[model samples]
Target: MNSDHYTYRVTWSAEDAEHVGLCAEFPSLSWLAATPAEALAGIRSVVADCVRDMSAHGEPVPVPLADRRYSGEFKVRIPPEQHRRLAIEASEQGVSLNRLVSAKLASGA
Candidate 1:
């Protein structure tokens, strides 16, 4: 199976004294190793095994979040005060609130 469809993250774990690899789709599954590469490899191997087993049992594998389609738009809820502040800032900058917020978000601020 192509393991590229899965999401893997490797992070250091002080408790285990090793890097830990986790798949967001399969929260219960994890792998640990002295190095990030080893941890990732271990997790990939385990994921492959899991996929094969699930396939054999006629269980469905989850679609990875990365593989899902998304619309460019989404909604956010902000407090009335915060919304007022942002509206004032956007006005001061001579831009629509959406334009200001979009610019800020794009800049990762």
Candidate 2:
């Protein structure tokens, strides 16, 4: 697994009074530093070490989020009443429920 392809994020930690680095693929791993750059570097190093150890032990390493493929379709459950309401709204708009829902999600609703 390429650690460089993993999803990384840097954010401030008020409680720690420092920056924190996070890897989405390794939710349990984190690094803290006084600077964002250092925090990111630290996390990347840690991830690299972890990957090496796992590989040496014949353990399966996690696939980076960037390397994963996502299907466009996913199932979501909602109350029957809400589903009915959405169906009615889609009908009123002259569109399929899927299209209406897709548009809403795209708009970050």
User: Which has the greatest TM-score?
Assistant: 2
Q: Residue by residue across 18-108, what tens digits does model 2's lDDT show?
A: 9999999899999999999999999999999999999999999999877889998999999999999999999999999999999999999
* Per-model TM-score versus the true fold: 0.80, 0.96
lDDT of 1 by residue, 1-109 (tens): 4667889999999999999999988889999999999999999999889988988899998778788899877999999999999999999999999999999999997
Taking every candidate in turn, the Cα RMSD to the unseen true structure, in Å, is 2.1, 0.8
lDDT against the true structure, each candidate: 0.92, 0.95
**How many clashes does each candidate structure show, in the order listed?**
0, 0
Candidate 2: deviation at residue 18, Å?
0.4
Q: Model 2: how far is 88 from its true place, Å?
A: 1.0
Query: Model 1: how far is 107 from its true place, Å?
Result: 3.3
